[model samples]
Target: MEISDSKKRIEELIEQLNKFAYEYYALDNPSISDKEYDKLYDELTILEKETGYILSYSPTQRVGDGILSQFSKYIHKGRLWSLDKAQSFEEIIEWHNRNVKAVMQYNKENADKLPPLEYVITKKFDGLTLNCTYDNDGIMIKAATRGTGEIGEDITAQAKTIKALPLKVDHKGLFEIHGEAIMTKEAFDAYNEKAEVKLKNLRNGAAGALRNLNLKETAKRNLSAFFYDVGYNEGDPFESYIDMMKFIREKNFPIDDYMKIARDTEDIKNEIEYINSIRADLNYDIDGIVIVINDMRTRAVLGYTIKFPKWAIAYKFEAEETTTELLDVEWNVGRSGRVSPTALLEPVDLGGVTVKRATLNNMDDIKRKNVKIGNRVFVRRSNDVIPEIMGVAEELENAREIIAPSNCPSCGSELMLVGAHYFCENTLSCKPQMVKSIVHFGSREAMNIEGFSEKTAEQLYEKVDLKTLSDLYKLKKEELLNLEKFGDKKAQNLLDAIEKSKECELASFIYALGIPNVGKKTAKDLCKNLKSLEGIKKATYEDLLAIEDIGEIVAKCIIEFFSDEKILRSIDELLAVGVSPSYEETLVNDQSSFMDKTVVVTGTLKNFSRTEIKDKLEALGAKVSGTVSKKTDYVIAGEAAGSKYDKAISLGIKILSEEEFLAMI
Candidate 1:
């Protein structure tokens, strides 16, 4: 091809690829397959090479092959103000009261009265803060870390790798946008699966990715981002926080879907509770909720403190992470007979719980983290339940190397090395293995046997010689009565619960089987798509990968799990004992107005909770979206609807009140 033709083709491919990326990452929708995307990307690379011309915004420039010698410093166009934090609801109340008082005082002093106190609430993302500057031509010129609020380390090359962040905007002005650069759980797991040096947590994964001198390494992290604030703008100023967010959205920046206007402390509290409830389910981590005054004028009146803006405060959640001394390491065997390392830590209060022990994962994780006894280590309470040692925090001269155990801790069996873990093949005799398996099989999310506990499982294993999951169904009330703490009532209740769990949901039963890399959600997804136990068992890698959220790792795990003869025999034994797993498709209201429509719900609904409303919409076959766009079929607006409602109106989309929505249904 000629140079001119190649250059034109390059521009076309860049535009096409960027649009596809925006759809996939920013909009959570993909128009084409990954294979198709790669094909275009390959063509773009070839074209750029042939013409010896590479545009700044071209997708080819995203992941540079070269490594930088050192990081250069860049001064921010505007100071990035830190938010004051509130640890308790009481503290948040106090902050709100102060804002209310200030608003009243301002109204009394000035001729102009500030609007009723309103705040914009968003998730306080637990990731590295990045500030990106776009020049007059709307091309991203520089990207830097939030260092000292005024000055930052230049990471323009590293930042470009975040496909969610746009390299160019339609706007014709110089501006600075601030966002949290995050590593999603999917990305984190994928990276750690193959990484020689494993990342400790999601926050560290993102921070280390951007700070790395090697651009290729940074790109490998597959960092994502969420833009919230336009710190500096050369164009016309925004009148309100809502307007600023709309502007950010208009520029096709990757903004988080959640944004709500809270009129009072009750609304803020409700939002906090909602976020906390779903925090574990989110793809990324959020440390807290941020509440900022919506009115720009009201913010001006409230002013700033020496360290933080008075108008905005972060309602901090209980600390999921902290540092504590690693006193020792304990090796334990799990249900799968895999021997794992658990760190014995100096007692520390984390997330309101006294944590003395944390999971060290495996020997490979230990070596990669470089954790040792006597070293101060970073510990995190994962999923608000399991305390996990993330990485080494501070190394000491007295630190001793942590060695993997040669034998099983529970049984005297020799440990066999497997991939990144050690396993004891004697699963039948290992007390911890059998006990844990029984306990897991009877847990709430699994078989959900009421009155079943670890103590109960241990007693059954030791006293009654309950050897397998199938043996639970054969348990007589007389057999249970011989165990410790088992009375007539308890024994009968245990038997009843076990009997009830026989007719269980297919998803829950699948979860009870303990497939690696498969969680409750994944199990549910499997049941939803595959529909039956036999179908799931026979599912090929291609079949499993065809389902959403089931990546190659998970697909491989599922295939391997079902391929095991012992597992198949165990499952067969359970099925023979009348353990009938059933799945029923959720019947939607096909006649409802929301059927097959894309709808967005905004603000506070008086009659329905957030979860309730979302459930209702799904039942009505509506695809509920977070942001309002041209494609939105309808927007259900409640009291004090903010940017989404406004955008819906501007786009001439249908708007419905709570009453109207109810009436339609």
Candidate 2:
């Protein structure tokens, strides 16, 4: 019950909960009842309320409601779309009402009166959705799902075998099809029982089924699909949802009989109510109700929201149940030296992934979660990102008192609170902070020093009187060779790699300096105009503020870096040691056609990532915005075009579709 023992207890509970999540969600074969799971969840929830512990990965924080396969990276032909969630009934109704108005507005000019239209409501299966592309020959060429709604996975080899998918579609030239890949309850149980690492739920099973190496292997699983709609087509394939269903059925798709086409809000409500009532009885997974417009053309005009389609909405089903024990809380410092705390739970399985640590943003967050050692807490991980301690469960006031850390554990420096972080004012002198800076400098993205691993850096510091990173360049090859276990070959490689990096760009050098808040991209921008180390040193804070992405924090870091006599002396010493003080900027013609225009770079490029391209373009004085807009003179499209591509075309704005964008770059 002691606070010191809390870390160990939380780790244990995390393991247990992770196992439970694996059984319940990923495997879909629960050994315990829903009520039992809730009991465990309730216990943890109560503890979180008192102790303020939040593990980064908690079962309660996860979305997908279950485990999904580690999604394979695929170059999508079109960008995968993310859906906008509706939290309240009013929000859902308001969304529909707006869509109805928009659809009417679009058709108003053509006719005297708007046609009376009703939406078709169907079950929204909880399983991941896939967009399978079929050639006219009926061969499955590509398979993707809505990943950020821009680009999706290329699961062609895996999609080739999903049973409901036909070898060929009835009408296909270049056609894009949509469907939900799902695992049935029986198959989920059987797999959980037989498999070495049991899938936690049917969703996981479906995902696993998709990633299977062999078509035969995928076929071995009882996976099914309900072909939704053909998003892309050379021509009209079906007039209505009913017609589309019949077409897919004729083509050998396994359409679920429960798919009822409900027209009118009353009918939609009735269907949603019915799905919710019998949700537990269904053989396949149904997360909620999916409402779509029967008219494909009309659906197109309705367009989409930032994340989801504005034309339709999903009414989600309530989550089943879960539980876990709260044990302790821990705190970690980030790159900016911000101390963030996390809740430690007794081991728990979430969506097939082990959950242990959840974030407690700060002292305020700790109070919000109210977590404590030896108390029960409810937790959830959302969007597979950070988990939150939702609430506390049963109380254990008899346990030893829990207390937050007063000093930084790594340096034993007294902690000072700043915003949401507990800071150690000794940024330059803190041992942990010092080594972390050195590691950042030697990183591939920062300095590109291949042989300068963290282990070597640490060892060098201990073996010699190394105070700063500049000393690394001063180490003689023979001196390194004489070090423990380091022979001539390894030492020589390290020396050569270090020598090769001396000629690195000014931006990379800036990033390597380990200045606070100066990220890679920002560093690149700093050098784009300044071009030399001395230029940065000479520039005023006002001068730095002129550059894009150089906010107040970054500007402050830049000013401080140049002002520090130690940092300045270190750089002067590095240049004296044959390092590039500043590299000459590549001469690029400013008269280029795209100059002065705002652009957005998206999707996977054959040559460069969006970041790389953005860095390169900024170096040339071109503005690249993250989001697409009217000001977006060009959107450099890559393999998969997402909503941005559609948005650009709709606005009658010029677009450098991925291929064209690549050529321009």
Best by lDDT: 1
**Model 2, position 100: C-alpha lDDT score:** 70
Cα-based lDDT for every prediction? 0.90, 0.67
Which candidate leads in TM-score?
1
lDDT by residue for model 2 (1-665), tens: 66545555554554466556544543234677878877776665555544567453333332122333555765555444555656556666776778677767877766544345667767777777888776766555668865655567666555544434554444556777678888888887776566555454577678877766555556556566777676666655666666776676665555554565655666776676666655665667776777777766676667776666666777765554235776776767654566667777777776446778776567765554455677776665543576666556666775343466888876678988766568876665565566677788878887788877667766676676566777878879777876777998999988888888888878888888877777877777788767778888888988899987688888887888789887788888888888884666666658766678788776667878666787667656678787665557777777655546655765577877656755565
Task: Report the Cα lDDT for residue 258, model 2.
Answer: 57
Query: Clash pairs of candidate 1?
Result: none
In model 2, which range of ten residues has the least summed lDDT? Answer: 59-68
Q: Write down the lDDT that model 2 would get.
A: 0.67
Report the lDDT tens digits of candidate 1 across residue range 438-554. Answer: 998999889999999999988988889999899999999899889888899989999999999999999999999889889987998899899999999999999999999999999
TM-score of each: 0.77, 0.50
What's the residue-level lDDT of 61 in candidate 1?
78
Candidate 1 regions exceeding 4 Å error are 1-13, 32-53, 437-454, 464-481, 485-665
